[model samples]
Target: MDIKSFIDSTYLKTAAQAGLDENQNQEVLKTFVNEAIQEGFKLIMIRPEMVSLARKIVLDTSAKLLIGTVIDFPSGNSTIETKLNEASQAITEGADELDFVCNYEAFINGEIDLVKSEILKGTQLALANNKIIKWIIEVAALTDQQIIQLSALIKNVVLTHFSEADYNAVFVKSSTGFYKTANNEPNGATIQSIIMMLENASPLPVKAAGGVRTYEDAVAMIQLGVKRIGTSSAKEIVHRRHNQNEY
Candidate 1:
């Protein structure tokens, strides 16, 4: 596949009700998508609120639009019913694909039943609309043991979600980009561990976000078996390789 098709570079804004209220969030997001497309990047990720607007804007363009509604965003504290309801609503709003941040607290606290149910419902909802499901398992909070354990369960989960023949596009994502710094990002080790886990998990793809802000970073994740990178710095990476004089 083309590299463009394999990357979901820009992901969603945190839910406003969830406390991330950037006044310029919408414009920043729109410009990010537009720039990504202009620079030949494909598959711009959009929030639930901006999904329809994204789809509308990119309808005439070749760039593929992907809508990512965080299930239990930032903190995976929402009840299973709320996550399911969110999934259904996002799909109804015209999402080409669904990236769900699976319930992390459940995983950490050994509430595997809760974890499984949320994933099952979300995947089912995503499939009901014929949308692709991308599961985000926040990697930073996990230890090596947890990572491996999650991957083992994800193996079974993916099998249940997609048959061997239908597993072509399943994605196991690394982070949600919740942590940041003044100069850079974090989570390379986390991403690497996730990739290693996925190697054992199944044939499903893996996506690495958070801290992947450069071409070298993108290439490193891709080398480690990440099929995608979810970052807001995609344009900067593209710029590093381009010269204005050449254009």
Candidate 2:
């Protein structure tokens, strides 16, 4: 399946929250970057601050890896200007892709215009800089109907404002892997959610992020036509496939 091509090896944890100081965090990021280079993963997703480091690690390598970072990360509550500013910095630092957390909270609150405006501005920002953009819908936080509506909404905005060729440059991603459910429900991508997203978000690609921890799980998502798989377990999944091929 050439799984390496489908993986977006990810590490977006904060150093302080992970109980590591700055030095330790850098070391960890170095290791993550090195691993991505060695395994030939599609892209390496890291925090905005580490884009340059990841970019540098693969700059000399023969592997053609892409550098990706999150914008408005776990929460999509930030102002449009703030997201654009952060995205501009990451692009200048060598980020090839930007996964934006859409303001789903605002969408649910009937601020539909704001949500649409946010995505429109963010997508335009990335496209202008020649960087790919993925809109993270954070499906775990919404109902089935909301998911469908939001997916269609994002598609509508891109199609309405941009040319057809530009559609592929943007993606509808599932989950930030950081949204907390009010009732303690599991967060991130689920089979049901992925199915719903794929069915609704057409013309634009789909990226299934979060909760994809095993090789089989990832393969299942790919079979469902996901253009990319976002997970911190990318290395493990690829290694597991290698091990199985040996037997």
Candidate 3:
């Protein structure tokens, strides 16, 4: 299935969040970048603050890996201006792709216009700079209806305002991997949610993020038409693929 191309090897946690000091986090990020280069993964998704660091690590290497960063991270509650500013800075720091957390809370509160405006502006900003845009829907935090509605809304905005060719550069991603849920509910990409996204957001690609930790799960998502899979288990998955091929 060419798992490396489908995978976005990720490490989005900051030093404090990961229970490590600053130097430790830098080391961890270096490891992620090196592993991606060696394994031939499609991209390395890290915090916006680490874009420049990652870019430097890959500069002298022969790997064709791209660098990506998240905006308004785990939560999509940030203002549109804030997200645009974050995206702009990331691009300046050498990020090839930007993953913006969609304003799901606004959408749930019947603020559809605000949600649409945010994505529209964010998409425009990315396109203007020749960077890929990924709108994280945080599907695990939503209901089935919300999933369908949100996917359609993103597709509508892209199709209505942008040319058809630009569709390839934009994507509706599944999750931010940090949404809190009551009763310990799931908080990442689920097969059910991914299917809903693929069905409603056609022509535009779909990226299943969060909780895709195994080779089998990743294969399933790709078979279902998902264009990308975001996870931290890229090495393990690729290793498993290699084992199967050897046998």
- List the global CA lDDT of all models: 0.68, 0.92, 0.92
Which segments of candidate 2 are over 4 A away from where they belong? 60-63, 182-184
lDDT (tens digit, per residue) of candidate 1 on 29-107: 6676677667676567767777776776677674655555555565666897887777777777766777777787689
For candidate 3, write residues 143-213 as lDDT tens digits: 99999999999999999999998999999999998888789888899989999999999989999998899
Model 3, position 93, has a per-residue lDDT of 92
Top TM-score prediction, candidate number:
3
TM-score of each: 0.83, 0.97, 0.98
Pairwise lDDT winner, candidates 1 and 2? 2
Ranked candidates, highest TM-score first: 3, 2, 1
Record all residue pairs in model 1 with backbone atoms less than 3 Å apart, i.e. clashing.
Answer: none
Candidates sorted by lDDT, best first: 3, 2, 1
Better of 2 and 3 by lDDT: 3
Residue runs of model 3 more than 4 Å from their true location after superposition = none
Better candidate by TM-score, 1 or 2 = 2
Residue 180, candidate 3: alpha-carbon lDDT: 80
User: What C-alpha lDDT, on a 0 to 100 scale, does residue 111 get in candidate 3?
Assistant: 99
Instruction: Estimate, for each residue in 163-243, the C-alpha lDDT of model 2 and write its tens digit.
Output: 998988999999999887778776988999999999988989999998999999999999999999999999899999999
